[model samples]
Structures are given as C-alpha cells and as structure tokens.
Target: MSTFFRSSLRSFATTAKSAHHNNHRDNHKFLPPTSFLGSWEAPKDPKEAEAKLAQLRRDYAKQVKELRKEYIEEMELMRLEKQRKDEARREALRVATEERKRLKAQEAEIRAQQRNIEQQQFRETLLKERAEKLEYWRRKVKMHEEKKAEKNELLRRQSSMWVDEAEIEKQILDTVIATTHF
Candidate 1:
C-alpha cells in the first residue's frame, strides 16, 4: 500500500483502540503525573513536618545550583567554538581577497603588454609604408630626368643639321661653277 494509505489505516486503528480503552477506563481512576510522587509519609508532629520541608527545599536548591553550573560551562564552550569559527571565516575571506587581487594584477599586466605589442606593430607598419612611398617617388624622379636628357640630346642633333640662307646660296653657286669646269 502507499505510505499515505498505510499511515491513515494506522491512525484509524489507533483511534479505535483509544475508543475501546476509553470505555474500559470507566472502572479505573487516573491521577495526573505532576501530583504523583514516588512515595510520601505524613508527619505526625508539626516539628517533623517542618524539618522534612526544610530538607526537601535544600535538596532542590543544590540540584538547581549543579544544573546552573553545567549550563554555564556549556555556554562557555559554545562561545569559544563560535569565536574559533568566526576567526576561520575571516582568515578564509582574507586569503580569497588576496588571491583575487593577485589574479587581477596579473591580468592587468598582460593587457598592458598586449597593448604595447600592438602599438609597436602599428608603428612598424606605418614606417614600412612610408619607406615604400619614398622609394617610389625617388624612382619616378630618376625616370623623369632620364627622359629630359634624351629629349635635349635629340634637339641638339636637329639644330646641327640646319643652315643659314646666305650659306645655302653660296653652296649653290659653288656647285654651278664646279659643273661648268667639269
């Protein structure tokens, strides 16, 4: 059977038994536990009764003192245990804080190094591009000079081939005279 069903069954059985017992209890008289001491004697005289009462009072006072002493000792032990636990907790927190700080410091240092490396690489790339541009400009200037020089040489050769008008006439007369002599 399910636990709930079994428990309900047991509860019902106990209720039935209690009902039967209650019926039987009509013939029996019950006393409260508080009013039932182990055994008692009635003192015949007032003096004896007074003495008995005093002894009982003293015994209860002693028992109360012993119980209070034990309670105080137990409280002291508990206080010491609590103090020790608190100290351990504080120490653990301190150690964990230090470890976190150390880890953060290491991470910061690595980040700084990474930034430095990136900066250096960027600078190197910029310098290399600038050098390449400078070399390209220098080669362009050299090529322009070579072209200028070649053009000047061609112009000089063309000027040497030209003659004045007077020189051309004299050359034609000399040619006619030479043809007549032949």
Candidate 2:
C-alpha cells in the first residue's frame, strides 16, 4: 500500500512539475504559487533533510490556513449578495401584485358602473313600453264606448216609434225610466 501511495505521489509530482513548467493554469489550484522550499536543494545529510522537511510542512500549513480564510470571506460575500438579490426580488413582486390588485379593483368598479347604466336604460325602456301599451288600450276603450253609445241611440229611436198602418213616430229619449216597463 505504501509503495502504491508513493508511486501515485511521484506521478502526481512529475505531472505537476511539467504542468508548472508549461505554465498551465489547470494545475494552479493544486500547486501553491510560492515554492515552499525557497530554492533550497536537498542535503546529503539525513539530519539536514529532516529539518528541511519540517520547515516545508510548516510553510504548507500556513498557506492552507490563509487560503481557507480567503475562501470563507469570499463565500460570505457571495451569501450576502444572494440574500440582497432575493429581498429585492420579493419587494418587486409585492409591488407588482399590489398594482395588479389595484387595477383589478378599478376594473370592477368600472364594470359595476356600466351595469348600473344598463339597468337604468332597461328600466326606462320598460316604462316606455308600458306607456305605449296603456295608450293603445285607452284608445280601444274609447272606441268601444262610442260604439255602445251609437247602439243605445238606435234602440231608443226604435223603441219610441209606434208601428201602425197610418203613422210612424219616435219620441225623444229623455230618461232611462220611461224606456223600460217595471
């Protein structure tokens, strides 16, 4: 397992080195911008190598801490921006909804007014039709009364006349009492 790990690490290091030499931006996240060794070469002495390795470890740790803090600050700013945008969107939606409601209410009022006008017109029309019908019936009643009067006059003239071989006469119709027998 150790051999496998070491081999993988060696391959990663070679690839990183080559990518760096080629100035490839793809490996920039994995590799630190500043060299931790600071141009130091490996010493033949084991004690010197151990000291250098410890120093490299401290430098790597410090870089990671700084990067983590910067990342946290950027994430906080991003979160604040998202919250502000959400609040603005909500406010816009509320305003738009209020405007829509106001317009809808106004439209309803207009419709009610129109309905009132139509109802008033309908009432006026109904009254006019009723008056026309009443006038027609009044004329019919007057004509009926005139016909009945003519018939009564003819009957009065016929009733007062005496049928005789020598004379035909009609008396004036003065009262209804004289025209009937009790």
Candidate 3:
C-alpha cells in the first residue's frame, strides 16, 4: 500500500510538472514578473527535507480543516432549507384541507337551508289546498241545505192545499143534503 501511494504521488507530480511547463511555454510573454526569477530552491539535506515535509503537512491539515468546516456548514444550511420547505408544504396542505372542509360545511348549510325552504313551501301549499277543499265542502253543504229547504216548502204547500180542498168538499155535500130534506 505504501508503494502504491508513492507511485501515485510520483505520477501526480509528473503530471502537474508537465502541465505547468506547458502553460509556461504557451503564455511565456504573459508570465508574471515574479516568474522570471526563481524564489525558492530545493532542500539539500535530510533535516531540511523533513522540515519542509512537516510544514507541507501542517498546511495540508489546515486546508483540510477549513474544507471540512465549509462542507459541514453547507450541509447544515441545506438541511435547514429542506426543513423549511417541508414545513411550508405541510402548512399549505393543512390550509387547503381546512378550506375544503369549510367549503363543504358551507355547502351543507346551504343545502339545509334549501331543504327547509322547500319543506316550508310544501307545507304552505298543503295548507292552501286544504283550505280550498274546506271552502268547496262548505259551499256544497250550503247548496244541499238550500235544496232541502225548497223541497220542504213545496211539501208544506201541497199538504195545506189538500186540507183546504177537503173542507170545501164537505161543505158542498152538507148544502146538498139540506136542500134535499127541505
């Protein structure tokens, strides 16, 4: 594993050196003034190399720490955003459900009112019909009573006429008998 890591690092260094050389060749005239002069030299001794490696390690550690902090902060921000969106969605759904229920309740109330109105109208219609029927029956009864009164008056007149005729006949018979006896 150590040999593999060393080989990989060597390959990365060779690639980075070739890329740098290519860029330097491509834009030689646009190079910075500082690039004209070499600022640092390679360490010679083992102690110097060790010190440089230690410094590089320290710098790498600081960069990794900063990167980790930034990554953690970004992840936390994303989580908070997701939570806020979820809460907003939940609230929206709750409001929609409540609105639907309110509308349904209002519809039910309207239907109830309509039913009440219909029932009242039906009752009124029935009352009016009953009143009309009662009036018709009263008129019929009055007509029947008038007819009965007229029949009774006719019967009474006929009976009185018969009595008067019988009295007249008896007087006439008595007169004839008196004349015969004389």
Candidate 1: Cα lDDT at 171? 87
Locate the minimum summed-lDDT window of 10 residues in model 3.
Answer: 31-40
Model 2, C-alpha of 112: deviation from truth (Å)? 2.9
lDDT of 3: 0.92
Better of 2 and 3 by lDDT: 3
Candidate 2 per-residue lDDT over residues 106-172, each given as its tens digit? 9999999999999999999999999999999999999999999999989889977745533433333
Give a tens-digit lDDT track for model 1, residues 103-138. 999999999999999999999999999999999999
Quick one: RMSD of model 3? 13.0
Off by over 4 Å in 1: 1-43, 157-182
Displacement of the residue 25 alpha carbon in candidate 1, Å: 22
lDDT measured at residue 33 in model 2 versus the true structure, 0 to 100: 66
In order of appearance, the predictions have TM-scores of 0.61, 0.57, 0.64
For candidate 2, give the lDDT: 0.87
Better of 2 and 3 by TM-score: 3
* Residue clash pairs of candidate 2: none
lDDT of each candidate versus the true structure: 0.92, 0.87, 0.92
Q: After best superposition, candidate 3 residue 92: deviation in angstroms?
A: 2.3
RMSD of each: 8.1, 13.0, 13.0
Clashes of 1: 0
- Candidate 2 clash figure, as a count: 0
